[model samples]
Target: MLYGVCYYPEHWPKERWPIDAALMREAGVNVVRIAEFAWSKMEPRPGEYDWSWLDEIIALLEANGIEVVLGTPTATPPKWLMDRHPDLYMKDAQGHTRGFGNRRHYCYNHAEYRRLSADIVERMARRYGGHANVAAWQIDNEFGCTDTVRCYCDHCRQAFQRWLRNKYGEIGKLNEAWGTVFWSHIYNSWEEVVLPAYTVFPMHNPGLHLDYMRFASDAVAEYQQVQVDVLRRESPDKPITHNFMGYFAEVDAFRLAEPLDFASWDNYPNLHFDEKADPLNSAVQHDMTWGLKRQPFWVMEQQSGSPGGNFIFAMPKPGELRRWTYQAVAHGADAILYFRWRTCLFGAEQYWHGLLPHDGIPGRRYEEAKRTGEELQRLSGRWLGTGAGAEVAVIRSYDNEWAMDIQPQSFGHRYMAHFKQYCRYFYDRHIPVEIVSPDMPLGRYRLVVVPHDMLTHPASAAALHAYAAAGGTVVLDFRAGIKRPDNRMEERTIPGAYRDLLGLRVADYGSLRQGDTRPVTLVRGDTAAEGHGGGVWYDIVELEGAEAVAWYASDFFADTPAVTRHAYGSGTAYYMATEPTPALMDALMDRICEGAQVEPIAGIAAPPGVEIARRTNGEKDFLFVMNHDEHSATLALEEPLDELIQGVRHAGSVRIEAGGVHVYERASLRRD
Candidate 1:
C-alpha cells in the first residue's frame, strides 16, 4: 500500500522543501501529490513554462525515497488563458459568467478551454512520464466540485443541441422521446432546442431536464477523456486517476472512471461527522469508489485534520484519525494519502488544517499518522490484493438520482438519504455490502437491495427479474419503477415495470407531512410488532399474487398492504410501500436475510457500535473489526486468528478499546 500526504511545494519557500521531504520520509510516507492547483506557478505567461521549482521539490523527495503523484493543472487554468479568451468562463444558470478568480471556472464545452487544458496536461505528462520517482498521474482535481458541471453558456447550448441530435437521430424522435407534446414544446429543428435554463417558472420539462443532466455528465466525461488521451500517449506505464468527491451525484462517476486505470476518492468524513452514522456513510462511499472498477482504490485526499473553507469542522479526537484511516482500508482502499502535509498560511483554505500545523511542527495529528503508517507498513504484502467479500449488493443509479432531483414527489424524499438508509440496515447488522451500478451483473450477489429506483431502465428491470428467477433475493423500496428512462411517468399501474416481479400494484399513494406518521404492524411467523411509518411518503398496495407481511394500522389506508413478499420463480421478491422506522427496517432485514441465507461476517454477533467487515483473496480471509463507540467492545471469536497489526495471535475473544481497530488474518474462510 502507498501511504503519503498531499504536498504543495509551491506554497512554501525553497529552503523548506528538503525539511518537509525528510519529515515525510521519517513519518513513513512514501509518496506526495503535487501541482494540482499550481497552474499560475507552472505558466507565468500564456506560453512560457517554468519547471525549476517543481523539479527541485520532486528531486528532493526522490532523494528521501518518496515517490510523486503529479496532478494535471487543468482544474485551475492560468488567468492568462482566461484573460485572452473571456468566453472560456462558465456561465451559470442565471446567465452570469463565473470568471477566473476561483478554480473550476472554465466551461467544459468551450473549444478554447478544452484545447488549453489538453495542452497543459500533455506538457505535464511528457515532463514526468519517464521519471522513476513519479508513481502515478491524477487527471485534474475534483471534476464536478463547486457546482461547475452544469454550464449554460452558448458553447454548452450548441454542444447540447448536437448531443441531442446524435442521441435521437432527428428532431421528431427527440420530441417523441421527450414527450414534448405535453406543453406544445415540440421542436421543429435542432436549432430550436435550448438548454434547460431560465424557465418561466422554477420547473423545466422533466424529460428535458433529465436529458440535460445526461448531456452535462457526458460533456465532463468527454473533457476528461481528452486529457486521458494525452496521458496515455505520453505516460503509458504510469496509472492515471481522478479524485472523486463523496456524495457527489451530479456527474456519472462510473462513466467518469470508465477510461481511467483505477478510481480514487477524496474522503473528508469530518465534514459529515455523526456519532452513529459516520462509519456507515464513510464505508458506503469507500465501497462505491471501489465498485467503480471493482478493484482496490486509493484514498487520494484523506482528511488529516479539521477541514474548513466556509465553516470550521470538528477535530478528530486522539484516535479518531487512526480509526478513520483503518476504516478506509477495511472497506477497500489500498492506499491512504492525507489531504495536505502542512496547513497553509494564506488563501481561502488557510483554515483547512493538515497533518502538520501552521507552525510546520509535527504535532498530535502527525504522530498519529506516523504510527498508522508504521502499522500499515508492517502488514503491507499480506493484504495488498485482498478485497471486500460482499454477498449483498445495493444498486445505485445516477439516472434515478437525477430524476428524483428534478421532481422529488415529496419534501422528505431524498434519493441519497433513502439509498444510504438501506445500506445502513445491513451495516448495523455487520453484513458486508457492495454498492454497485444498476447495469452491472447481479448474479454474484445473494441479496440485492434497490431503494426508490423511480426511473428504471428496461435492461435493469430485466436484470432484476432474471436475478430473482435464478434464486437471488431482491428487496425494493417505495417508488420503484414508477417512471421510464425519459423521466416520464409510466402510463401503466404504479410500480409499472416491477409489478410483475413484485406481484402487487399500488392503488393509491400520498406524501405525509413532516412530524406526521401512521402506524404499521408487521408479522413474521409468530412474532408481531407495531412500528411507525410514512414520515416521508406512503403507498397503499392491493395485492394480486403476494402476501402482506406488514400493513398500515392508521390513516385512510389502514390495514392495506404496506409491505409484501412474492414468490417469483425460484427466489422471493420483497417490496416495502412506505418508509419504515429503524426498528421495523431491522426486523424486515432480519427476516429477509434469514430467507436469503446471508449471514453477517463470520456470523459474529457484535455490539451496537461495533462494525465487522472481511476482505478475502479466495484462499485467505482478513477480518477488520472496528469499535466506533466510546466504550470498549469484547467480541468472542470462533477460532484462532493472527492479528497482523500487533503481530499477536488471539483465540476465544478479543477486546478493543473505544475508537480502536483490529485486523485478523486466517488461512481459511470463516463462511466456508
Candidate 2:
C-alpha cells in the first residue's frame, strides 16, 4: 500500500522535483500520479510526440522507490490537436465548441476526437509499456459535461440508436416504455432517434434526457477501453482505471466501475458535511468505492486545505485530514492520496492549497502529512485483507435511485440522503454493513433496511418476501413504491407483498402546510415500543390487521396512523408513513438497532456536528472521532484507544481540537 498525490511539473520547476519527492517520502507518500494536463510538454504537434521529459520525471520518482500512476495527457489535449482537429472539440449545451483553456471541454463522440486521442494513448503505451514504476493508467480525467448541452449531433444520434436497439431490442417496446402515446412521440424507426440534447428535443424530459447521458457515458467508456486495449497490447498485466467523483450524478459510478480494474474517487464535501450530515453518511462513499472494485483503492483526490466548492471551501482543522484518511482506510483504501503535493500556480484552482503553503512555509500542513506518514509506517501491513464483515446489507440500486428522484417531489426527497442517515446509525454501532443491489440475495442478514428503495423488479420483490418468510426483518418506508424504469408502477405500495409485512400501503404522500408535533409517548412507559416513537409523521393507508404503534396527533391527516408494526410469522415489519423528524428517527432507530445484543460506542458528549465511527480490521478495532465543531472539545472513552497519528494513548479521556480527527486503535478482541 502506498500514499500518492498528483505533482505537476508546470506548478514547480524541474529543480523542485527531487526536494518535493524527498518531502513526499518523509510524509509517507509512496506514490505519485504524474502528467495530468501536461499536453504542451508531452506532445508539441498533432503527430509529433515527446516523452523525454515524462521519462525523466518517471525515472526521478522510481529512483526513490516511489510508484507512479501515469495519467494520459488527453485531459488537456495538446493545442496542436485542438487547433488542427477542431472537430474533436466539445461543443457546449449553449452551442459553442469550447476552446482548449478549460478542462472537460472535449466532446467524446467526434471521429477526429477518437482518432487523435487513440494516437496519444498509443504513443504513451508504447513508451511506458515496460516502465516498472508505472502502476496504473489514468484515462482522460473526469469525463462528463456539466453544462446542459445535450450533444444532438449526427454521430451521437447514430450511437444512441444502436445503444437503444441493444437495450430494448426494437423501437416498438421503447415507444411503449416511454409512454410515447402521450405526446405523439412514437418513432417508427431508429433513424429518427436523435440524442435528447438541447436542439433535438426540449430539455423538459429529464428522464428521457438522462438516458442520453447513459449513452454519452457509454461513449466515454468505449474510449477508455480503446486506450486500455492499446495499453494491454504493450503491457497486459497492468491494471487500468479512471478516478470518479462521489455521488457524481453526471456519469454513473456503477456503470463506470464495470470498465475499471478498480475505482478511485475524489471527496471534497463542501460546506454541508458539517451542516447536518450524519458522520457515517460520509463513510458511504469510501465503502461504495471499495465495494465497486471489491478491493482496496487510492484516495484519488482530497483538498489539502479548503476546496473550490463553497466561497470559502473551509480549511480542514487539526487532524481532520488524518481522521478522514483513516476513514478512507477503514472503508477500503489501500493508499492515502491527495489532489496535489503543492498548490496550483494558475488556473481556477490557484486558491486550492496543498501540503506546502503559498507563503513557502510548509509548517502545519507538512507536519500533519508527516505525522500521518509515520502512523502508516507504524501500522504497516495491518489491514491488508481486512474488511468490515457486516452481516447486514442495505440495497442501493440505480433504478431505485432514479425512481426516487423522478417522482414529482420536493427537495428533501433525496435517495442518498435517507440511505446515508441510516448508514450513519449503523456505523456508530460498529456494525459491519454491505450495500448490495436489490437483485442480490437477502437471506444473509438478520435485518435488511430498505431506505427509500422505491422501485422493484418482480424477482427482487420475490427474494425480499422469501427473506422475510425465513424470519429476517424487512424494513420499508415512505417513498418505497413508485413506477418502474419502464414508467409503469412496479408496485405502488412497497410491492412484492410487502403490504402484509409493512402493515400499510403508501397511496400518495406530500408535505403538510402546517408543522405539527405528534410526540410519541409510552402508554405504559415500560414496554419495548413505548418510548418517543410518535411524532410529526407521513400519513398513509393502514392495513386491517396492523397495530397502530404510533399515530399522528395533528395535521390534516390526523387520526391516520403515521407508523405501524405488523407481525408476519415470526418476523416484524416497521413502516414510517413519512420522513420522520430527527428526534423520532433517532428514537425509532435505537429501537430497531436494539435487535443486536452488542452495546453502542460509548463516551462522547460534544457539540453538534461531531461524528464517531468504529470499525475492526485485523485483530485491532479502530475508532475515528471527527470534531466538526467550530471550537475544541474533549472526548472520554472507556476503551483503551491509541491515537495513531501522534503517540497518544487514552483510557478514559482525550482532547479533540475543533474540526480535528482522531484514529484510536486498541488491542484485538477475540469472541471465540
Candidate 3:
C-alpha cells in the first residue's frame, strides 16, 4: 500500500523543506503530493517562471527516499490572471461574477483560462515528467468544488449552444427533446437557446435543466482534458489521477474518471465526541468511488486531525483515527494519503488541522499516523494487488440522479439517501456489495438491487431481464423505470417496460406529506410482522401474476399490496412499492438473500458494529474483522484462521477490543 500526505512546499520557507522531508521519512511515508495550489508561486508574472524553489524541494524529498505526486495546480489561478481578465472568472446564474480570493474561480468554458491551464500543466509536466522520484500526477485539487463547475456567462452560453447543436443536429430536434411546446419556449435557432438561469423561483423546464447539468459537467471534464492531454504528452510514463469530493453530485465522477488511470476520493467522516460514526456511509462512498473505474482507488485527502474551531470539528478518540485509516484499506483503498502533513497557519484552511499542530509539534495525530504507517509496511507483501471482492451489485445512474435533482416531487427526496438505505441492508450483514453503474454487466452477481432508477435506459432494463432469466434475483424499489433516457415519463404503467419482470401494474401512486406514514404487514412463508412505511411517495399495486408479500394495513388504501414478488424464467423479481422501514427492509432483504442463496461472509447471528470484509487475489483470501462498537466483543469463526496481524492461530473465537481490526487468512489456504 502507498502511504503519504498532501504536502504543499510553497506554504513553508526553504529552510523548513529539509525538516519536513526528514520527518516524513521517519514516519515511513513513501509518497507525497505537492504543488496542488502553487500556481502563483510557479508563475509570478505572465510568461515568467520560477523553478528554483520547487526543484530544490523535490530534490530534498527525493534524497530522503520519498516519491512525489505532482499536481497540475489549475484549480487555483493566480491573482494576476484573474485581475488581467475578470471575464474569465465564473459568473452565477444571476449574472453576478463570482470574484476571486478562493480557489476554483475561473470559468471552465473561458478560452483564455483553458489556454492558461494547458500552458501551466505542460510546463510543469515537462519540468518534472521524467524525474525518477515522481510516481504519478494529480490533475487538480478538486474538480467541482464551491459550485464553480456551472457558469452562466456569455462564453458558457455560446459553448452550451454549440454542445447542444452537436448533440441534437437541428433546432427542431432540440425542441422535441426539451418538450418546448408545453410552455411556448420553443427555439427556432441555436442562438435563441439560453441557459436555464434566473428562472421564476429557480424552476425552469426540467429537460432544459437536465441538459444544462450534463453540459456543465461536460465543461468541467473538457477543462480537465486540456490539462490531461498536456500531461500525457509531456509525461507519458507517469499515471494521472484526480481527488474527488465524496458524495458530490455537481460534476459526474464517472465522466471525469474516464480519462484517468484510476480514481481517488477524499474521505472526511463527521466524527463527533462520544458518538460512533456511521462507517457505512463512508464505506458506501468508498465503494462508489472505487466503482468509478471498477478498480482499487486511493484516499487522496483523508482527515488527519480535527480542526480547532466551533464548527463540527470533534477530536477523534484514542484509536479512532488509526482505525478509520484501516477502514479505508478494508474498503479497497490501495493508497491512503492524509490531506496535509502539517497544519497551515496562514490561509483560509488554517483551522483545518493536520498531522502536526499549528505549533509545528509532533502531536498525538502524528504518532498515530506513524503507527498506521508501520502497520501498512508490515502487511505490505501479504495483500499486494488485492482488493475487496463482491457478489452483490447495486445499480446507480448519474442520469437518474440528475433527473431527481431536476424535479424532485417530494421535498425529502434525496437520491443518495434512498440508495444508501438500500445498500445498508447488505452492508449491515457483512455482504460486500459493488455499487455498479447501470450500464455494467449484471450477470456476475447473484442479486441486483435497483433503488431509484427514475430514468432507466431500455438497454439496462433488458440486461436486468436477461440476468433474471439466467437464475439471478433482482430487487427494484419505487421509481424504477419511470422515465425514458430523455427525462420524459414512460407512457406505459409504472415500472414502465419492466412490468413483465415485476408482474405488477401501479394502479395509483401519490406523495405523502411530511411526518405522514402508513402501516404495512409483511407476510412470507411463516414470518409475519407489522411494519411502517413512509417517505415522499408510495404506489398502490395491482398484482398481475405476482404474490403480495407485503400489504398496507392502514390508510384509505388499507390491505393493498405494498410489496410484490414474481418468478420469471428461472429466477425471481421482487418489487417494493414504498419506502420501507429499517425493520421491514431487513426482513425483505433476508427473504431476497435466501431466494438468491447468497450467504454472508459470516453467519447472520453476528453482533452489531462488527464489520467483516474479504479481499482476495484469486489464490488467497484475507478476511478483515473490524469492531466498530465502543465496547469490546467476541467474534466466533467457523473455519480455522491464521491471524496475519498477530501471527497466531485461532480455531473458534477471538476477542476484539473496541475499534480494533483483525486480519486473518484461512488456515487451509495459507501458503506457508
Candidate 4:
C-alpha cells in the first residue's frame, strides 16, 4: 500500500524533504510523487537541463527511506519552448494559438510539441532511470482542459480527416450516423467535421462533435503514450502512472489505463458535494482506479479538511473531512495522499493547505492533519494490500455516459441525477461493488445494477439478460431503452433485446424527480408501509406478466405501476418506474440481498460524520471504521477483531469514540 503526497522540493531547503518524509512516515505514506511542474528548475534553458535540484531532492528522500514516483515536466512547457517554437504551442479549435502560461497547454497533435516534449521525457528518464528509489514514473498532468481549446490547426484538421477515413471507411457511412443530411450539414469531404466543443452550442450535427470528442480523447492518450513509451524504453523495470482528474469524462480512463503499469487519480469534489456525494460515485470513481488493473492504486490527492469557502455555500462542519478520508480507504485505496504536503504561498491553489495551514499556526487544521497522519501510520500494513470483494457488479460505460449527455431532453431528463441515485442506493449499503466494463464477466456476482438503460451493447445486454434469466437478480433503472446506438428512440415501448428479462413494457417513463416523489407503499412481508414519493426517478411500467410491486397516487397515472417484479426464467427482474426514496431503495435492495445471501461487513454504520468500509487480502479481512463526525457515536464493531491503528489486539466487537478510527484485523491472520 502507498500513502503519498505531491511534494515540491523547489523554494524549500533539502531539510524540508526530511521533515515532510518524517511527517509522511508518521502518516503511513511510503510514496512521494514529485515534479509534475518542475520544468523551470529542471531545465534552465532550451535543450539544456539541470539535475542538481532534482538529484538532491531524490537522494535526500530515498536516503530517508521513502520511495519515489518521478514525473516528466512536459505537462507545462517551459517558457523558452513557447517563445522559440511558437508553432509547437497548441492552437485551439476556435483558432487561437496558446502561449506558454499554464500547464497541460501543449497541442497533443502538433509534431513539434511531441518532439520537444518527448526529448525532455527521454532526458529526465535517462538521468534518474537507474535510481533504486524510483518505484514508478508519472506522465504529464491532466490532458484536455477547456474541451473547446483542442487543436484544430492544419495539423489537427489533416489528421482528423485521415482519422475519419479510417473509422467510417467512407464519407457516406459517416454522413448517415451524424444525420448530416439534416440542416444542410452533410459533408462533401471528411475535412468538414470539426472537434467537439469547438463552440458553445454546436450548430452542426452532434455525431460529428461526438466522434471528435472520442477522437480528441484518443489524441490525448497518444500524447500520454509519448511520455509513457519513452519511460518504458528508458526504464523497463519501473512501473508507470499518471494522475487522472477524478470523475473527468475527458480522456477515457479505461482506454488510457491500458498503457500505464497501474492507475492513480486526483479526487476533487464540489465542496458541498463531499457530503452530498452518493457513496457509489466515490466507489465508481475509485473502482475505476481499482478496476483498471483490478488492484489497489494510490490516492494521489485528497483534501485534509474543509476549504474555508465553498464553491457555492455549503461548509464542512469539521468532522466531514475525516469521514471523507476513511471513505477512500474503504473503497480499496492502498494509500491516502493530498494535493500538497505543504501549503502554497502564492498560486490559484494557495488557499488549500497541507499538513500545515497557511497561517502556520498550531491551530485546528494542522492538528487534524498530524492526528490523521499518526492514525494512518499506526494502521499501516494491517490493511495494506487488502481487498474488498464485491458480490454485485455495476455496468458503466464511457460511451454510454457520453451518448446520454449529448441528447436534448424533450422530457426534462437529467442523466447525472439518475445515475447518482441508482448508485447511491447500493453505496448506502456499504456493499462492495465491482463496476465492470460492459463486457466483463457477469457471472462472478449475484446481481448487477444498471442505470439509464440506454444503448446496451448487443453482447453486453445478452449477458445481462442471461444473468437474470439464470436466477441472478438485476436492478435496471430509468430510460433503459430510450435510445439506440444511432441516438434515435425506437418506436417500441421496450427494447426487443431483453423482453423476457424485464417481463414488462415501459409504457411511459414519467420524470422521477426528487420533488416529484409521492407516497409509495411497499408490498413485501412486514415491508408493507407508506413511504415518501419521488416525482420521477423512473417511469410507468405496464405489466405484461410482471406483478405490481408499487404504485403512485394523486395523478392520472395514480395506481399505475411505479415498481414491478417480473419472474422470468429461473431468475427475477425489477423495473423501477420512478425514483424511490432511500427507504424504498433499501427495501428493494434487501430483497435482492436476501436472494443473493450477501451480507455487508457486520455491525457497520456510516453514521452522519462517520464512514465504514471493508477491505480484504485473501481471507485476512479488515474493517475500516472512521468517524468524520465531531459528535461521536458508540460505534459497534463486527467481532473477533484486533485494532491496527491502536496496535491493540482484541476479540469481538468494540466501541469507537468520536473523531475516532479503527482498523480491525482478524486475529487468526496475525502473528503479532
Q: Rate the local accuracy (lDDT) of all candidates.
A: 0.88, 0.66, 0.84, 0.68
Show where candidate 3 strays beyond 4 Å.
271-276, 307-312, 524-534, 603-605, 667-672
TM-score of each: 0.97, 0.86, 0.96, 0.88
156-266, model 3: which lDDT tens digit per residue?
A: 999999999999999999898878998799899999998989977888888888999999999989988998899889999999999987678898888899999988898
Candidate 1 per-residue C-alpha lDDT over 1-672 given as tens digits, one digit per residue, 9 for 90 to 100:
799999998999888988898899999999989999999898999789999998988989999999999999989887778889899889988899888677998889998788888888888888989899999999999998999999999999999999999988989988888889988999999999988888788688899999999999999999999999999999999999999885799999999999999899998877854433367778889989988988889999998988888777877788988899998888888999998899999988998999999999999999999999999988867778668778899988999999999888888668998888788888888888888888889998899999888888899999999999999999997889788888878899988999999999998899887657777777432223645454688998988899998878777788788789999999999999988877778887899999999988773456889888878887887888889999999988888778888888888767889989888887745443
Which residue window of length 10 is worst by lDDT in model 3? 523-532
Q: Order the numbered candidates by TM-score, best leading.
A: 1, 3, 4, 2
Deviation of model 2 at 468, angstroms: 2.7
State the lDDT of candidate 2 residue by residue for 500-590, as single tens digits. Answer: 6565666545653334435443232332243344322355565667776556544465556666767766666777776666666666667
lDDT of 2 at 149: 28
- The alpha-carbon deviation from the true structure for residue 29 of candidate 2, after best TM-score superposition, in angstroms, is 2.5
Please provide, for model 4 over 1-672, each residue's C-alpha lDDT reduced to its tens digit, 9 standing for 90 to 100.
465677888846676667766666655566788888888888879757788988887887777677888878877777777777677666765678766555666667887788878888888889888789998888877656545235667777777788789989999988887777787778888877666536656444557666666777788888788888888899889888777655677677778888887777777543444455443456567866777667777777776544432133243335544555677777777776766677666665566656565643435544565566666665656666766777777766766677766763424555656566656656656667776667677777777777666765678778877887787778776667665565555556674456667777876554443355566666432223656455554466677888877776545666777677788777778777667777777787787777766666565555555556677765676777766445656655555456776777655445667657777776323111
The lDDT-based order of candidates, best leading, equals 1, 3, 4, 2
Question: Is 2 or 4 the stronger prediction by TM-score?
Answer: 4
Model 4, C-alpha of 360: deviation from truth (Å): 6.6
The total number of steric clashes, by the backbone 3 Å criterion, in model 1 comes to 0
